[model samples]
Target chain A: MEQPEEVPHNPTEQAAICFKAFMLKNSPKSNLNLYDHLVRVLCKVMDERPENAVDVIEDLSLEVKRTGMRDKQSTLRDTPPVPAVQLLAEQQKTLFTRGSGDDVEPEEELVETPLPNLAEQSFYLEQAGVGLPREELQRIHLALKQLVDAQPLQTCRFWGKILGTQANYLVAEVDFREGEEEDEEGLQEDGADEEEKEGGAGDEDEEEATEEIDPLPVSAYKPPPAVPKEENHTGVNKFTYFVCREPGLPWVRLPPVTPAQITAARQIRRFFTGNLDAPIISYPPFPGNETNYLRALVARISAGTQVSPLGFYQFGEEEGEEEEEAARDSFEENPEFEGVPVPEMVDSMANWVHHVQHILQQGRCVWVNLAEKPEEDLEEEGDEEEGEEEPDEPEPEVGPPLLTPLSEDADIEGTPPWSCKMSSTLIPQFAIAVLRSNLWPGAYAYATGNRKFENIYIGWGMKFVGEGYTPPMPPAPQREYPSGEEITEALDPSLEEEQALQAALEERRAAEEEAEELEGEEEEEEEDDY
Target chain B: MGVTEDELKDKKALYSLNCIDWHLLPLPTPVLLAEVAAVAKGRFVGDPSFEYELTETRQQGEGDEAVKEEFTMKVTEEKRLAATVFNIEKDVSVVPRGAFIRTPHDTVQVNHSFQGLSTLEARNLGNYLHFTEPQQLKKKSILEMADLDPSIDFLDPLSEDILKGSWSLQMEGSSMCVLRSLLWLGLTFFHVPATPQHGYIYMGDGLKNLDLPFML
Candidate 1:
């Protein structure tokens, strides 16, 4: 906790020890610094392996006599020294010591005092910039205060991403279950209660009650909703499952953002790029981007569920404590699917009718597309997805896929380090089987005291919701989509072409009607003006 | 200091693209010459009532990757109509022959408002210089450098605290442009007990960051 145990008495050794302390978070030393090659290598070694840097530095100083790698002009003075060990035993101990039963890790006060803490309250209340004065600040604060009174800031915003967007159709939630560490949270709450009492706050009973309760165990972190045995209508409970990253806050999970919502989020981001300050408004009877294709495919797999319902089922065993016990007992693999199954590419093509019905059902949100009797005209809207300009000249029955996948899902992803082996082209029949598979080993949440990390177990099998993340009704694996048409109808002609023709005709009819109405209005206006 | 009126004029705040609650049909590729006229009926792109004729797709990337097309995209715009009627009236980006195909009656101006991250000041790392609020040596460092806007006040981003895990990683650009501002923009995940996923702020003038498809 204090300084290292053995502070070397010699000046050179002391300098070496101090250098190692800063080395961990510093950039590596350059090789071209030393004039001689042999001495440079020794200095490099000393610089790299800090613990025994002294001994290595000493040995190299003598050995410069044999090897010719050293520059001829360099001398013993050029060789930097090192300490005798691998790493300081005490320093190593500090790094490894578990947050000592508390959530606080080895937090050395590297800086005795923090710089002026930035104001935590919203800057909307601040009086700064070119012309505003204290009077303006006070007036604006008072006016806004009258509106909100004493209510805490209701941080309203959505965090969403399209799942199965990866080539392999794998989806990952960055901060899956970030509930505070077990008793550590409870212990902190107890400390807060004491502070409240000192401040003469009178909620002692509530504070006492909170202090008495132990923090929920880490295992108790609710996993993704398990496969829903109970049907989840998009309108009622679908958003509860959306996993998104907050604007700034990382761990807090907002309601589940639909694939359509993710697509919307992207468009919205770009829309605002030009118009930085505009209120979110509504216009079309739309669902989302071209997400229907994937959702349709998922629709087939989900046993005709209108939407690719995430709540429908769990992929494998919940990676809870009990599953770990079962994992030790079994070693066989499920060879059904090559990789895990998830809802991927759900954004490219979407089922607007199905998606909109859900949006309409969730009445009070900003993103609702109010259409007239939307459910009744569902069949009509499906045709809208097809672009109006259908090529009159028919091509072969199975032609090249229409929306040339701008690039492979992986190609688009550019193979970052976090990527695991997955597929852009999925196996449908095997996907169903994969979705039913258990949690793979490497993908479980890892939280030790204050340290928290979770990697969704990526595997060669398809992923399904375990019981924990599943909704009310646990998943009973359903039948797969009957048509073997992922590549055929989704990419190629026929479905979209036929729909496009229908849409073109419909557009013509609507245009004619609008034209006639405009003519009538213009004529009447002209007569009135005369 | 009082907020300048010009900052108010210049500061465009677009909050949500979800404003169009219903999705529009995917922007029709160059095909639909007839349909384009119909939608553009006396409006922005097709207001002149130009004869609708199918033309070959313009801007076709040559070679193996060129998309096989059913209809051509190059439409003779009756005239770009000054590109002003659609509220892109001021400081609109002009093209040396604009690429995004536009018909005179094209009513819907391609407007996107992805409220990008607030002002971030990054200096060339070689000299270990980090620009602050005022951008001058002392003033910016003294005053907490913040891109203050009332709209983003609700979403309080702790940009002033560099050590608070909200700093972006300086990575090589994704080849989005020939001329990069040489500045990387991205959102950072705060150092909380249970969270770790931050991403580059890749939304801006195409020159800033390439539109990479993957979510990091």
Candidate 2:
């Protein structure tokens, strides 16, 4: 048989394929350690390649500079730098072209001339800006080392936090035990040393006594036994577990908390009150203000998921259908369509109601008081009329209508006359809860559409009761003007009172005019004399 | 009436700002020019009592290759108002290709080259040319040229528009300081819009009406 045909081995092609495969496998882990390794390997490879290496280095340097600048601006400030691909390309080119001495020499010289300075400057700038200070860098390095070493343990805690399980408790217990043993050893040494000195024991005897009482055994002195793991105290663990591990979902790991996160959570909590289990509907907070912290929290919580508490009234087919049906029913029920422009009246009433509700929600009682004053006046007028006709004295009522009774007809406005006091008593608890929780600033389903109007009525009622008054009715439009004689007759008594007041005002005005005239005349005389 | 050279130069400058290139107008024929010359010289050209029809034509082709059409002029003399009407046998272009028009204060160029011309352009041009005289061409509108140059004196009424529109006045001589002041003004007054066309134009005053003379 002929000698086996020798196969040509293309190392460059093989390396290229291997590199591609490696990148494909590990590119997703763009974290710091892998990034550093890539950078170092690429640098080493480029150092061997002399030709086409300068361009690669320059491109890499530019990339590093760009990343350094971006890292400064990025919110995730501690993210590690990723080495430039150009650097790796340069290394590959250098490695492939290493045998060509003539091409490599000039390129090497060029790379050598500026490489150090560019690298130094880039390093200095990065360190000055985004890179941590020496102390911080040391701390980070140590922390990273610890993290790597204790990754298994940390992973357990992380999973435990997410799963709302007892993993964290078990870890805490283990740590507690180790701490107690160390403390016991320290205590025994201190106590035994003092006792031996007080007894003035010989050195050998002291040594013997020390040997007899083992320091390790002192650690066995256990305090009162810890509560059993199965025992539930205050149900805090159960609550945390429920919040962490709800059905049909994996536990989510929380990102490191920042000041912004804290503020956002607080704001969201303040608005939501009914039940923890209830879905939350969050509204975009006021723009250009710190109030967006609440919105940001809601955004974070709702991130990676579509579940939101504030999703009840999102514009959709169902909502539109309901609105249409309601409109139809309202129209059919209304009998008086002869002359009244129902739509305009309804719009105005809705607007008025909304205004009242907004004021109440804002905790502004003054506006409610203003609105109710007219109603109170009308009620008082009616009461006066009744009293005059009956000629009977009646005791004034003590307290305004209680809010609890108002809830029965809360949805309707014209059912019966009631004080705001009743409505407040009924809804105060819910309102207070809303105010305290993080949910107050955002949109809510109950606060939308006709519900807003209902809230306004409630607010108006609250103000009415608070101020102890009802709003007066508007006067009817005048059909015609009175004749001159009739007007004179109607105004006679009022005109007499007005005449007296006018005469006094006129006398005062006359005195003032005379004084002014005298002053003017005197000024003219002075001018003439001059 | 014949216009002086100075009047022509002033008109040229006004036309330049309005982007009107006047050199493109078609030259009148020798016979038509003779009639115009006779009329201008006050001689009984063709028929003083008997009416001779005058025609105007406008074409849209390039250079000397453009075509022309004829039209008739109906002239009426009244003590109340002077009126002239042109009757066209063929379509006579009402708007010239590059006639300078004025609206309120600013000049606008009439571009008949555009597929369809707005009537507003014709009305504006008529208003401006009707009101303006050759002598008044050099006199600029107080509001129009106010913010164009900053070297104007504040005390001068001619510079009132500039002064009013001036967003800043800094101590003279320092370029850096001036730049900083400008930067401050840019940050404070500039409204960076999501779209280029919708970007906010600071009108100096609080007025937001588009009809206002001010534009960025």
Candidate 3:
């Protein structure tokens, strides 16, 4: 409008040198310890002279990108490149100081051992809809009180979060003490003396190193037996596990469970990907990886869905001829058992029972390996070939025993893969029951009203099979090719004799023809010369 | 900071937690009620032709260039109970004999040469079929369906239905099986036995058991 104030004083000195190179190119490192929170957000937008000064500097940079200082600037972009004098000595410390005597108290914060009140056990396991998330039950009660103050456990617990595809696991379980079972059987006899020196180093390189470290091959796997080191503390090697991938990470442990990885994790169903060495793969294949298939799916979900309610466990007293004396009985703690009437544990899965053992479909709760010298030379070449095939082979199928009952398993669609329910159903005697399983969909268990119980699981370590994960298919293709035999007695000739007879006749005629040819040849030679 | 004294003297000891319940359980968050409905809409300014449609399309063009255009529309009541429970779950699920196959590009799948259904062919109903579409061999012919095997005969068999003993089956324990239907009251299905495992579910009340041909 009026171009004369010295031609806008060199265009306001080229707009103050383009606003000091746009505030030094959006000032991130002018030692940006948020430059006193960007000068207290430009003195609160020049003391609220706002009616939009670029919407109050875009609402104070979207309130400094919702403050965890953008997660400490995305964890300081994963750390390493610091220098400029240690980023100006970490921007001269005091980012927020106040009563900061360096808040100490973490010198091995164990406090001996008392965790379980997992927020009152997830508030009585969310009154039976079974729980978790209250910040993952306070990071699994501070990762099971730092795994019972790091080791010789004698009881640890917090075992839930499985749901893998990258990272879930959690687990824990434990037990140990009583001289830690001879130092866990001398570290499992040094992993059975390094798997018997990798199975005496050459049963053909241990069957090609178990078909290149197992995905089940070794001649369609038969092994499934060896569990008798006196049934390692009872049933699926009673309580040890560990796992981790979260809740302050480090745990791991998990070895014990073998009966050929509980018979290839009961013919593999697979899911777990919080990779503890992943490769389970599948199709009658999973012989090991994923820490022996999460210790044979936590010993087949602790011997088929853990269970408890009916007289909290008792049987123990066998103590003698152990070779599978009803799987050396075991079970224990029934201190005058009590609790089972949340309307009789919400009426029937036969009032729950299997407090862990029965495994069997040759997945062991005691199989014993039966004298192995190559299984007694394949039972003497199958007793010199089928001496009545040892009475038609059949018998391996055991299962259902330890305290048996969840109405003896089975029922998939028409219900009963342990459902139960209680925790209130209008206060059925201070209720607790629960149960759940439905073929391992996040397990559950629950009990209480005094003689407690437990189990838990938390899913995606798959099993409910049906409507999806179909898998099985590989068979049908023969479609007609076998039966064909038919060329009944034809060419009955004494061929050599017949040939000699014909040769004799031909020899005579040849001599005669030869003579006539010589005569004709001579005549022709002469005719040509002429 | 509570129940200590060794978890109140652990009676018979059971306290647990071994962690699982992965994600969906936190819930409770949604709050805003738009600042108490904008202070009760500045003290009452309701009903500007209030609405509650839920799906009834067909607009075309008008004011702000409106154009919903769902051709022949108006079918509410929750879209006729979601098209009668998706046509009775695509006419009662089923699936057995070589579970599911077709594919040589004619799409379908699951079959992996289906090694399942053996407990006496999962208790007969003529060894199941109908995972839908084959509607009575698409009205016969092809020389009266000469023993069809078009990659596990394209579905529809359930013992040539039209009401003959409406399904049933059973064996829910010695390795599952189940089946059910009875002309569709909460359907059912299952499978298991030899093992490729099977499925189907349905749960009821979307209403359909039309007196099942006067209860057979």
**Model with the higher TM-score, candidate 2 or 3:** 3
Error of 2 at B31 (Å): 31
- Residues B73-182, candidate 2: write the lDDT tens digits: 53211100110101010011112212223333333333233332232332121211211222332365778557533221111221122222222221111111110011
Cα lDDT tens digits for candidate 3, B1-216: 113332112112111123343222111112222222122111111122222133336777798999885443222232233344445646786778677776676766666768887676676777788875667878888885788788777777788888776666655323566776756555777888788888777654333444344222
Give lDDT tens digits, candidate 1, residues B31-99.
Answer: 443444332222122233344344544446778778755564333333222111111211111111111
With candidate 2 superimposed using the best TM-score fit, by how many Å does residue A473's alpha carbon deviate from the native? 25
CAPRI tier for the interface of model 1: incorrect
User: Taking the candidates in order, what DockQ does each have?
Assistant: 0.01, 0.01, 0.01
Summarize candidate 3's per-residue lDDT along A1-530 as a digit string, tens digits.
Answer: 24223343577786876665455454454333444556667777788777767756967756754552565655444556643334433432322222232245444333444345667667777887767658656655766666665676666677676755334577777777766543655777688778866765646566566666646634543453454443456667777778876555567788777676776666556556567987776666765688878878877776778778787877765643563544555657778877765666777777778877777755667554444434465575466543433323444555556777788678764445666667765667677778777677677878776777777777655555433334456757646535555644456659897798668756854775676765666555544753
The lDDT values for all models are: 0.27, 0.26, 0.61
The weakest ten consecutive residues by lDDT in model 2 chain A span A454-463
- On lDDT, the candidate that comes out on top is 3
- Higher-scoring candidate on TM-score, 1 or 2: 1
Which order, best to worst by lDDT?
A: 3, 1, 2
For model 3, state the Cα shift of residue A381 in Å. 10
Q: Which candidate, 1 or 3, would have the higher lDDT against the true structure?
A: 3
